[model samples]
Target: MMPVQVVGLGLDGAQGLSPVLQSLVASAKLLVGSDRHLAYFPDHPAERLSLSDFHSALAAIVRAAEAGVSPIVVLTSGDPLFFGFGRVLLSHLSPEQVAFHPQVSSMQLAFSRIKVPWQDARLVSVHGRSLEALTQALQQGAEKLAVLTDPTNSPGAIARLLTSLDLPWQYDLWVAESLGGEDERVQQWPLAAAQQTTFAPLNVVILLRQTQAPVLPTALPLLGIPDVYFASFADRPGLMTKREVRVLALGELALPADTIWDVGAGTGSVAIEMARLGPASQIYAIEKTAAGVALIEDNARRFATPQVRAIAGRAPEALEGLPDPDRVFIGGSGGQLQPILSVCRDRLRPGGRVVLALATLEHLAEVSAWSREQGWHQRCLQVQLARSTAIASLTRFTPLNPITLVTLTRSEPSPL
Candidate 1:
């Protein structure tokens, strides 16, 4: 039987190739690999074959073995088991027919240079996958990521994606290019600056989650922090609902790990906070002002809630093309409370929850009457917050703005 050895060349350096691996490469009757790997065995008389297609390469290896070749060598990069070509070849060829020789991976070298432990980090190859998947992971606030990048999905592309998401935190990126080569270079920069760079074709992208990770929590808190804790834009200033009021509204909304719509979302404080509660859930902060949209993005990054998306147009108009929400929160309706509620009632999933926060009793009456007309159960709460502030070198009590909370739960009619 022909001896087939799968050799891993760690970053193409002399130290990365073992003596045994070197001997195998020297004795092989046929060498199958990329041009760079073939260059390693310049003295070997074996027929140098380039692997551009998997089927063609496999055919060449099998043909050499049938022709009385005692040994065949297939070259790969890094550890054969770690996102290398060995896995694919092994599936096509019997395990008993092949032997693997691994080397330290470039990923390991890159992480080592940065002095960060990577045993727990998530490693992904963007070689042939959609960049959208990376976006999804980023939205979930993936702390440690090692992205294997090509020229198409380079560090610049990643920076653009993060910038478009409007996440507030800065990323400390390490770009390691031409690793193990004499010309290898490793550079660190902020995400914005990284976007402006043009890295070598071969490189890895490392993101160090900064200290300012969003305030968003990974798990849902039974009672969330008050809305006052979130940073909001000055345009809608005090228009945001208080933390106590939001908790009551969220309770009635019964949020699920599906999708949500925060209509008239001022600064997107609630939307971002909701995303933090459930990483899998998608929160759309629908607001009309440019400043409000920017605020939502800032809050999402500040809280580490990447799942919150800010829509910069007005409701009814902005609501178009958004995923149907499992639950809806209407924070400020601008006198269109009834119309917005009417639209949301029809759009909401069956048995879904809708919570409305209003400052005036008149809007509460309007929403309550509308809910009753729709055969839905409505609940109301008047929340007043009295906070303590510093006065004359002593603490004094001050009243926070009072809010009227209304919630409507819709249920399907049961069979008579």
Candidate 2:
């Protein structure tokens, strides 16, 4: 059987359609496409088919081809291979039976109209898919994103989703509607403004992440940061681990270029640091408190750890249905330490390490005993930090809360 060609007609107008593609459509014995696509070829006498009913249209294309139709032209928007009907058609018809003629996608035009480079941007389709995926992508520091909007998943809904997550206005959005049509329209605005505005039904949303101006280099050492780097809540008030303690805890975990779970992650200090140290690793900051979760997100952005995942909800309960970890750190497990430890230890691959930070000697003893019972090797450290302060007319030192660190490594062979 002769191959059917899937061609893209650029949104600019009929003239935007490639010459070769137009020729194919003109010579085709049968044409299958959307209502908009069919309107582009007014002079063709072929049996025009509407793609609104995809199953029937597909069957018609197959039947016409079997009847010796030399070339069946399938008209599509943008590049056929990019989230278009070409993939579905090719899956049913043999690849050898189809040819693809690509054109500039609405997403590409949207981005180009805004004059932003999209090489590093995350392109996602929100058409009839889970919004959770989009949430996860944004949470993982997706700077720029090209979202394909549908009737059910409109631009307004997407904007609402971002606003619900309290995402900052770090993006400039370009909404392109009915590209290539007489009613074509494009609107550009900051994310904050875009969230308040409504867009046309057929549109592509392009988000360009805002860039910060460069800062002069500082002379201070890089590893340990001062206490002020984090956003703290009044109730916990200094409950977050100190900068020095975080550095030591990160080292003890010996995180690898894999997945690390910061269970009971508070303010995501440890998780953010791990992401900074292990550039190739994914750090999951699992926190139970809403305030702590928000702090983790703020800290993650502040530290430029794009791969850190700030997860809301508590440990063990929140840790349900998470990916297995190569390293785990428990910072604030409440009283469900045993359950959290069990879940993390079970999820850790062989050779995986788990680090626990306890505030009291009693908790340290409990974890130590638990580690021995689990047949894991353990090491403990008591960290006491003293900061220089001015007392009256002289300089003095004050001791902060001491932290106990417990490190554990599983000796069992990995099944990865």
lDDT of each: 0.73, 0.74
For each of the candidates, the C-alpha root-mean-square deviation to the true structure, in angstroms, is 17.4, 17.3
Q: Estimate each model's TM-score.
A: 0.56, 0.54
Clash totals, every prediction: 7, 3
The local lDDT score (0 to 100) that residue 246 gets in candidate 1 is 68
Tens digits of per-residue lDDT for model 2 on 1-416?
A: 25598888775646886676567778887888899878877888988889999899898888777667868888888888998898888778778888888888887777776777888878898887756566556544477898887765666666656555432223455788887667888887654676567667779887654443123236323555554455555344355777778889877876554988888887777787788678899888898888888888877777778899988887788877778898888888878888888887778887788888889878888888888899887877888887553221234454657898888877643433
The RMSD (Cα, Å) of candidate 1 is: 17.4
Q: Per-residue alpha-carbon lDDT of model 1 for 1-416, expressed as tens digits?
A: 33678888855544567687677777887888888777776677877789877688887777676566667888888787888888787776678777888887879989987889999777888876667566555544566888888777788877766555433333567898988787799888776787778888778988865544345556545456644446654323345666666676776666554989999888776786577667899888888877778778887877678889888887777787987888889997766777788778778887677888888878888887898799997777788876543221234444656787776777643322
Q: After superposition, how far is residue 397 of candidate 2 from its true place, in Å?
A: 46
Single out the weakest 10-residue window by summed lDDT for candidate 2.
212-221
Quality of model 2 by C-alpha lDDT: 0.74
Clashing pairs in 2: 11-180, 288-313, 288-314
